[model samples]
Target: MVRGKTQMRRIENETSRQVTFSKRRSGLLKKAFELSVLCDAEVGVVVFSSRGKLSEFSSSSMQRSIERYKSYAKEKNLKHRGAEDNIQLQLCKQEAASVAKEIQLLETSKRKLLGESLETCSTDELQGLEVQLERSLTNIRLWKKHMLTEQIAQLKAREKMLLEENAALDRQWKEECLQHSAVSEEAAHDDRTSQHTEVETDLHIGLLGRGRTQCLLQA
Candidate 1:
């Protein structure tokens, strides 16, 4: 029988500590053996003393018992993990289904927003939207027409200005040519008159000198 309450702390005395360990080790091995025999369970236990000595217990051959225990524990862990994975897979499927439903609802809402829910639309609403679209198209066409008309008017105005400028330049050029021709003619006439005047003055001087020489000979 256990005598007293086991202290929670480690025993400070080496002798007490060794005694406690020996007692616990014996008890654990005995319980393990009884459990295997009565419950048809497999068991394996191993211990290392402070001095590096090995002790072990098993219900069957130690290798067989240890292998069996490992196999049982592995199967239990695998089964538990598989169950958890199945639950997670189910949750994922449910979430995916819910997300798909949400996406469908959003798609429907978007269609409605885009005015594709014709069955739910009233006649007035449909007519109003149609009228608004027609008015918008009319406004756009009118803007295009106005732009085209303005562009044509601007081109016509530019053409008219160019024509007027061309006419003015032609007229100015003709006037300049006429003025230049008239000035050239006047310069030619002035040159001929100056030449004739010089010839007449020379002839007069020659004839006067001859007449004076003849008068001196007669005297």
Candidate 2:
């Protein structure tokens, strides 16, 4: 009678287990060859013993058979890689969105600091912003003070120049006044001498007329 089908359990005896492995490995290879021959197709088989020994069979040179297997494997990998690339693209988009969100937050913060009040900010936040504005105002005040100091220096320089110009004008005016006084004194002296000479001539003529009258009466 045909032995009943062996139970599906591990063979406890090492020799039996090894023998079974060999038999199964050979049967699988034989089946592979049969399939190739019947279908007029290429075939390859590879097995490893429990002791880590390798066994292989192929329709062609082992290298060529491996290369062919790799080519077919690459085709499968390409299909999987397309899916993987889509997943990676989705991940990249998510990361970019996250980065964009972070950038928007930073921009909002900067805008808040620059005195732009948005609906997102609270009154307390606005107060903090006001403090920062006050600090900025203080700095501006200091800068204005510096500018005013420079302007004051410039004004002082202009004032000194004006003073010098005024002093020079005063000197010129004093010199002109002295010249006019001297001219007036000389004119007055000439007028007095002319009047004295006219008076003396008149007195001499009158005396001469009285003497002529006396001499005619005596004649």
Candidate 3:
């Protein structure tokens, strides 16, 4: 009968657990020693038991091996970071070149639009430029016409406002003139009444004085 594969798990019994730990630690140390001797490699192994006991193997001093591993890992990380930085630098250069090319194309097109560099243009290009210019002119004229319409509407509105204001001012001036005329007439009537009263009193006094003189002459 074929033996079934055993599942690996923690040994529950304390004695069995200790025995397994001892066996595994020794086997790991032996492997590290063999690897160092046979392949001339720097090998290190470390293990800790549940009770905080330590087991370690190193081709050289443990401290030296740990320091070497740290330095090697640090150097490898620096090399990887430098490679990423180089890739980023290359990408930036490509993007800058693309932007520069786009700017150059835009400048060339601008010059063409301004009629500054037409000597190198082909017949088809000139025709296209002419069509573009005509379309632009049409759009400009339409915009100008629309602006003028708006301006005319605004001016008409302003004229209507001014006319309304003038009408209001004229009506106010007419009303003020009517009030002034009425006041003047009232003042003139008062003056006339006062003069008439003074004249009547003077006439009555003259008549009475004459009667008194006649009565004295009779006496």
Candidate 4:
């Protein structure tokens, strides 16, 4: 019969757990010894029990091996951190490029909606087109209203100017009429004085003629 594979979680029963720990520890130490002997390598292993008991295997001086391991770990961490930083920089660049492309696409869509382009627009874009058109129409109405109000204000100003001009002209006409009336009255008075003087002179001449005729008849 074939044995099934064992799962790697902790054994729950206290006796079973202790038995498993002993067997695994011995196997691990044997493997470390064999690796050092066969390959002429520096080998080190450390294990800790649940109760904090320490176990270790080393092919050479344990203290020297631990110091070497610490230096190797520090150098490896530095190299790996540099590589991770480079990777993060590349990711940031790619993300920026993607965001720029998205902004460009949005700008193109806006231009299309503003009547700057009709080509390449699809039925899929129609939903956004309606919203754009509504906003455009509202702006157009406001602009038209502003222009109309300006025109009305200009007309009102022109009306006021014309009324002022007409009033000025009327006042000038009335002044001229008064001056002409005075000139006419002065001319009429001069004509009446000249006519009265001429009539009196003619009557004086007629009386002299009658006096001369009566003196001749008496003689």
Candidate 5:
């Protein structure tokens, strides 16, 4: 008898859905194991249930397999990158040339502002360069002021942190010193008590001997 095709839809009944998931998951894992054993192929599988429970299988070390896969992908990418190497080199060269040209223009403008190369400049161009140079100097001064302000703020924050750390260390040292002083006092008290006890015992013995000698003389 030909079995009817199962429709590809979610089972609305909760129990039926759960049962179907369990059966399918077991079959999938069994097939994976069979493939690994029969074909001697490295196989890994991971499945998550609707409840976020995980099931995993690996024929060999999963970590080794993942690293091997990454290596293969990296090797493929390296080979593909070879084709673009020349294009990247050309772009880098073009960028370098652009930067060099800009530097040369800036150097010429600087020389003109420093009273050199002014022989070729017209009166209008010289006035324009003077105004441009003043604006640039003003911008530089503003930038320098901003940078100094930022540095001062950073230094103040660092100084505050250092002060707080120093205060904590000083407090800790004071506490340790107090503890040590208390311990020393306690030890000194013990020693003084012991010395007093020894002196009392010796005096008592000496009085007892003197009393015995007086009794012998009176007799």
Candidate 6:
């Protein structure tokens, strides 16, 4: 029969737990010792009991082994970080080179657009450039026509508004002139009535004086 795998878990019985700890601790320390001797490598093991009792084994002095492990771990971590930084730097350089090449292509295209440096262009390239230019010119003309249409519509609206405002101002001016003319006619009528009343009063006084003088002469 095939042996079953042991299901590892906590031993609930206190006595069993202590027995397991004793056996495992001895086995681990023996393995560590054997590994150190057989491979001529530094090895260390540390164990703590539930009551905080310590057990340790080392191929060399425990303190020296711990210090060496710390130093090696720190050096390995630094090397890993440095390698990552180098990879990132290489990626950045590659991206920069790609961008530079793209910029060069754009500059060459721009020079072609401006009709500069055409001697090296093949006939097919020149024909393609001509087609591109024609397309660009067509697009530009369409855009300009659209813009002018919008401008003309705006100007027309503005002119209509101005004409409406001018008509309103003219109506207001005509109303004011009519009011001024009516006021002038009323004032002139008042002046004429006053002058007629003064003339009639003077004539009446003159007639009375002439009658008085004739009566005195007759007397």
Evaluated with lDDT, which candidate comes out highest? 6
Which ten-residue region of model 1 has the weakest summed lDDT?
109-118
Residue 51, candidate 4: Cα error in Å is 81
- What clash count does candidate 5 reach? 0
Clashing pairs in 5: none
Model 2 C-alpha lDDT versus the unseen true structure: 0.91
Give candidate 3's whole-model lDDT. 0.95
Per-residue CA lDDT of model 3 for 1-219, tens digit only, reads: 999985698778999889988997898899899999999998989899999989899898899999999999999999999999999999999999999999999999889989989999999998998999999999999999999999999999999999999999999999999999999999999999999999999999999999999999999
Q: Please provide, for model 5 over 1-219, each residue's C-alpha lDDT reduced to its tens digit, 9 standing for 90 to 100.
A: 999999999899999999999999999999999999999999888899989999988899878888888999999888889768978989999999999999999999889988898888999999998898999899999999999999999999999999999999999999999999999999999999999999999999999999999999999
Q: lDDT of each model, Cα atoms only?
A: 0.91, 0.91, 0.95, 0.94, 0.94, 0.97
TM-score of each: 0.50, 0.43, 0.64, 0.46, 0.49, 0.68
Q: What is the lDDT of residue 111 in candidate 1?
A: 73
lDDT tens per residue, model 1, 1-219: 979977699789999889988999999999998999999987788999888878899887899977777898999999999999999999999999999999998887567556787697788867876787789789999999999999999999999999999999999999999999999999999999999999999999999999999999999
C-alpha RMSD values across all candidates: 13.0, 20.5, 5.5, 18.5, 21.8, 4.5
Runs of candidate 6 exceeding 4 Å displacement: 1-77, 207-219
Write the residue-wise lDDT of candidate 2 on 54-126 in tens digits. 9888866678888988999999999899999999999999999999999998988898887675677888988
User: What's the lDDT for residue 155 in model 6?
Assistant: 100
| lDDT of each residue in 1-219, candidate 4, tens digit only | 999999989799999999999999999999999999999999999999988999999999889999999999999999999999999999999999999999999998778876777677777677678887898899999999999999999999999999999999999999999999999999999999999999999999999999999999999
| lDDT per residue as tens, model 6, 195-216 | 9999999999999999999999
Q: Candidate 4: where is the Cα deviation over 4 Å?
A: 1-111, 114-124
Clashes found in each candidate (C-alpha, N, C closer than 3 A): 0, 0, 0, 0, 0, 0
Q: Considering lDDT, which of the candidate structures 1 and 5 is the better prediction for this target?
A: 5
Q: Which portions of model 5 miss their true places by more than 4 Å?
A: 1-107
